[model samples]
Target: MVKSKSIYSCVECGGRVLKWQGQCPHCHLWNTLVEAVAEKNSTRFNYTNEISRVQNIEKIKIGEEPRYSTGIAELDRVLGGGLVDGGVILLGGDPGIGKSTLLLQALCYSSCDRAVLYVSGEESASQIALRAKRLSLATKKVHLLTEIQLDRIQEVLGKEKPNVAVIDSIQTIYSESLQSAPGSVAQVRECAAQLTRIAKASGICIILVGHVTKEGTLAGPRVLEHMVDTVLYFEGDAQSSFRLIRAIKNRFGAVNELGVFAMTEKGLREVSNPSALFLSHHEEKVPGSCVMVTQEGTRPLLVEVQALVDKSQALNPRRLSVGLENNRLAMLLAVLHRHVGIACFDQDVFVNAVGGVRITEPGADLAVLLAIVSSLKNKPLPIKIITFGEIGLAGEVRPVQRGQERLKEAAKLGFVQAIIPKANKPKHSVFGIEIILVDRLEDAVTAIF
Candidate 1:
């Protein structure tokens, strides 16, 4: 039998080292190494100890995996219809960001055909019940357990056999087999793996809540993400009442799916019109404002892109961005200077995606570029205009996917005009929207100005 040993792990990158050092040799993150006790391997894999037989491809049978509805349409959309049996989901967010409320509300309102267990290592039964009361949630089918020990939770799982189990957080749960404290790398990994095993062995679906670090990542080893079937992160500003649940990874559904919620006095209310919520309110469309339609998973969302260009008085012009990338902004400025006649070489540039929503797709490139130009020239584009396309280094406007869907969304939102790449011209003409196909950045500037 292998003996237990102590090992050092880098908290930043989850790299392991046999000995401690001032800095991690792999990730170069300083003062992030912590020691943890590693348990001996109780199960070994080798050719000499083979047990289960492998079946041939022709003899194997396939069937659709079963799923249960959480009774929330927005949640079901993000989850790809419903939660699958024997699947594990990890949800992480900032403190007081409504992670617990969302999960509890789902459990409380879900169709109670099966037993539901909520094992909380962070909050007690009373605390959860009080919050549920405040949220106006009531349920008798849900069972609550306040525990952190892995063995006790496993015992409950075997006895109750709930169709779905929710662990409040994986960081606070620990296994007795390891000497490491809860929230450590070893403990988090072990707890997650054991929970996953229990979920798969039985038909119970497991949802694990995770605490996020100051760096905005899950507070555990990176391997914890890989061991789960789905990973979701909550995004919203602390000052704002809006919340967005985004799926980073999903095995059974489409990834990058988004669910929008509004925090009210009672609880979270699903937003029926996400585009209106994510748009900046203004009586008139301003010079620095532009509209763009970007696809989030299977849904096409319209968002406002804003930009400000001012003459710099400081040594280095400030290049700041929110809900967008800084490096991409710099590249777009360079492209505008090189291709379009507009120049912002010595100006401080700031770009933002309004309403705390992030636009990652390249289709928003044209809208951002147009907004910057509009700000620089002190001119506003048409109020009923929407634009989306990819910008190349050579100043050519590139086509984006699902062009018709984008145009249709814009039209539905009352947009009448659109600027898109020439290559993305639709096969059939849209009824309400007038599409202006542009081949070069210079042509777009000319059309807008």
Candidate 2:
């Protein structure tokens, strides 16, 4: 019988320890030291001895080139075209955020003639089948397997030799060889490394689904994301139906590309022009609301900025912002007070980037600050005006990236006036709309108000 050796491991960073303590000195996580047993292995492979018997380095040769498209436009866009041959891609998102649904929908549309394996460790075959039925996908060549054992998954891949394989989640799959439990840092790291090797060796495109942490980062150690060839993050409001898939790391394609999708009663549907969905239809112009053009990755997006300012209730006024950073809003408010003398310290300020889109770019600085100004003054911005420019601490509107794209998106959305940074040169005059270039925030206020 093999004796079990006890070893302490940190739960947070997966660092091995000799003994347990009240606090983990490595990851700073309390009560994370747990003793795990591993079967003693007396025999080990001697790779150095084998290398001594081997010959010299041989000539390098090129390998096979084969890739397939999932037929989803938004997914393809984020992937920089399609899945690469022998690529390991990881897709991570919040629970119940339609990550599984989106993957199943994509697989359903793909490979009617080629064999594609869909493995799920969390759900049963019946559950996936019901979702497939709802998606109305004819899965002729698509195969579904519900298992968690790493050996079984490897066996299926070796036997079936599918063109593409998707693991519903990597956290749930565990190897009996590893003493650590599923979803643990050790298991997650080891399992991902094995899958990457398998995909590269067999020339298979494997897409692994991952769960996200509360901090909106991919769950598991940071190393799991680094192990894969491409890392795609599914982002959007849980309350809203719209979903955005963004590529954070892509070895084969563009890194910052994004794909937009909408959840329907049937399944996830791709939105070609996300600008239209974000724009609200209002017959009359509302006070404290204005339109702005912003860029997400390479694509330009047109969104609305709304602000509401009211009397303060307590000693400290409420500063609420949704889809926009709260600290940035407070900073902008301070800038308005100090430079422009807007006197917003005593009032309750609420600012939001409409359509559930989060705007972090300095390009939206002018739009958001102006919306607050418009709200405090009870003034309505011109119906035709749309603004895009970064606002400085000294009340200057700075230039934004891709000026032409922002102008084109605004013009396509029927905005007739634009107050942009004077530093940015437009490629050509846009037809119909009046472009008002401003150097300072005060100039923008004068042009709009």
Candidate 3:
């Protein structure tokens, strides 16, 4: 007869411990230890062994055929043109972030050349079908399956011979052989590993939807993220109707690609011109406002930057920033004081990127700095002015990449002037904006003032 055993696992790292402790030595997180039913000395059925019989590195060959597109241009762009065969992609986001909706839409509108299977452990076929109907996807080829047992899922995969498969979420699916409950680290890791092997052996593209922690990272163990070929994160304000899907890791394509979608009554609509949605058309020019062109992956977008500086009565002035790095804001403020003689120490500074879009590129540094300075000076920047260039510690304005695309986007959006790096030589004379080249931070301030 087999004997049952008990074990404690660190919730953060999934490391096994004989007993519970106040803090986990493996993950350093406090009070995250949970008692789990440990499996006795046992070995479950190995799927990789079956795969090894057929799939060796020497047996694989490269093909020239392109990846399969899902018929959504924005999604295709974020996925580097299309979904790669045998790729395992993990999609994560906060609850109600539309992770499942996006994949459901993709599966419904996907090119009908391949057999597609939609597996859901969280929702019923009728629920998913209703969503598909609202999304205007009334296709017959897309098969739906609702199951949680990993063995059953594998059995279906073997019989269905699907070219593409999607698991609604990873946390809900459990391997029956695992003694631990669903969403346990062991179950998540084991399931992800099996799915990855199946995907590679069958030449099927597998998309796994995953839940997110409160900190907004993919839930499950960190190993779950490492097991996949790509990690895509869906981000946006829950209260708002806009969402951004970004690829943070891709083995076959470039990272940092972004896809913009607006959730509506019908379904998610791709934002073809995102810049228009980011900028506000105000007849009267306002102080503490500026425009900047930022690049995400290969695309350039123009957005508005706003700042407010107010005299503080507290002993320590507060510095608050939204959609921009707070530490970077502090560093820029210090540089402004040291080089440009702007004393913001007695004032409370607040910086925000309009439209809730986060900007991480250093090219936006000059625009953010200028916006703060303009607000402190109570001066309004030119209405049609747009600027973007990296700011160095030495008060130098460094050149940004893809300057031509930035300028072109600004021009298309009715911007009349641009303060860019002096090193960028325009390919030809363009007329919409007067391009003012500046090589230093003070020069940018002067140009704007």
Candidate 4:
């Protein structure tokens, strides 16, 4: 018989210790270590006499993997042409961020006619049924189970080997073999490893809904992220109906891909034209409003970067921004002051990406700096102008990647002119829009005003 021993493990880093301590010695996080039982070393599978030894990579058979489409084009794009058979996908989001609703809708409209099982530990069967009815998805061939026992779930999976399984949350599932409770670091890691093994062995695609910490990350061991095939995050403001699904990691596809969606009473609707959604309409040209093209994966998105520079009332002027980084804003401000000779020391500056769309790429640097200058100078930029390029600390305009694609996208949206880095100037213009090349930030600002 195998014996069991007790040990404390850190939830933040998975570091284990012999005795209890207030703070983790490795991760230094306070109160994150939880006591868990460690079963004695025992091998579950023996393959000494079997033919399943290490094989040559060249000799291994390669077959085309099947893809299960969720019936959402945007999601399919993010997942790199739908879900692969036996893939483990980890979806994380804040409470009420529409994770469950999206998965339910996916199950309802799956293009693949395979059987699907959705296991939820947080909601009862009746509650799930009500939600399905509300979404008008009562007739979809999706099964529901509200069990949290990991052992029982595995047993059911063995009995009913569905092609796809959706675990509403991995944190709530616990193994009876473990003395620790659900959501503990030890249990969460072990459960995920076991489920992933099952997925590979049975060719069962599993999507695990994961709860996030207060810092907006998965609420279990950090290793949970490394164990999954893909990691997706749902991001959007609560006040706004617009939600963005972004892929941070993918074993089958490109990373940093984005899927735009709109939250509705019926369910989440995919936004076909995300550029139109992020750009606000105006009757006349206004100061501090500038259009910039950013690349989210292979897609080119045009969004308005708005800025407001006002006389300061306090000693230390207020610097506020939405959908933009504060440190980057400060750095841009410093560049404008030191290189461009634009004095904003006493002025309060506020910058935002229109429509609550976050812009992380530095390609928006030129547009943002121009927006601040336009607002400070009280001059509006030409309505037909589109600007994009990275800005260096030395006030030089830096060329961004996919310059031609960005220009074509802007021109497709009816822009007549573009201000880009000198390095990005086309040998021969592909679009009808006139290209304005600038090597330094001062040159672009001069051309604009």
Q: What is the lDDT of residue 79 in candidate 4?
A: 94
- As for candidate 2, its clashing pairs are none
Per-residue CA lDDT of candidate 2, range 1-449, in tens?
A: 96657777665676777677878788888876767764345432223222334445575455644556788888988887887878999999989999999888778777765568999999999998888887788877789999999889988998999878999899999977777789877678778887887887788789999999888888777778878999999988878999989989988777878789999998888998988766667798778897888888788888889999998988999999988888888888887887766788789999888788878787888989889889988988888788888878888888988998888888887888888899975979987788898888777777766
- As for lDDT, the candidate ahead, 1 or 4, is 4
Q: Evaluate all candidate structures by whole-model CA lDDT and list the values in order.
A: 0.88, 0.83, 0.87, 0.89
Candidate 3, number of clashes: 0
Stretches of candidate 4 off by over 4 Å are 1-6, 20-52, 61-64
Comparison by TM-score, 1 against 3, better one? 1
Query: In candidate 1, residue 163 scores what lDDT?
Result: 82
Pairing residues by index, what is the TM-score of model 2? Answer: 0.89
Error of 3 at 268 (Å): 0.6
Please write out the lDDT profile of model 1 over residues 1-449, one tens digit for every residue.
86658889987677889899999998998888889876566652123224668899898898888788887788888888789999999999999999988888888877367678889999888999898888888767889999999999999998999888889989999888878899999889878988887787787899999999898998888889999999999878999999999999999899999999999988888998899976877897689899999999888899999999999999889999898888888898999999876778789999999889988888888999999999998999998899999999999999998888888888998989999999999999888899999999999999989
lDDT-based ranking, best first?
A: 4, 1, 3, 2
For candidate 3, the per-residue lDDT at 366 reads 91
Q: Choose 2 or 4, whichever is better by lDDT.
A: 4
How many clashing pairs does model 2 include?
A: 0
Per residue, candidate 4 scores C-alpha lDDT tens digits across 200-296 of: 7888899999999898888999889999999999988899999999999999898989999999889999998899987879899899999999999
In candidate 2, position 356 carries an lDDT of 83
Clash pairs for candidate 3? none
- In lDDT terms, how accurate is model 4? 0.89
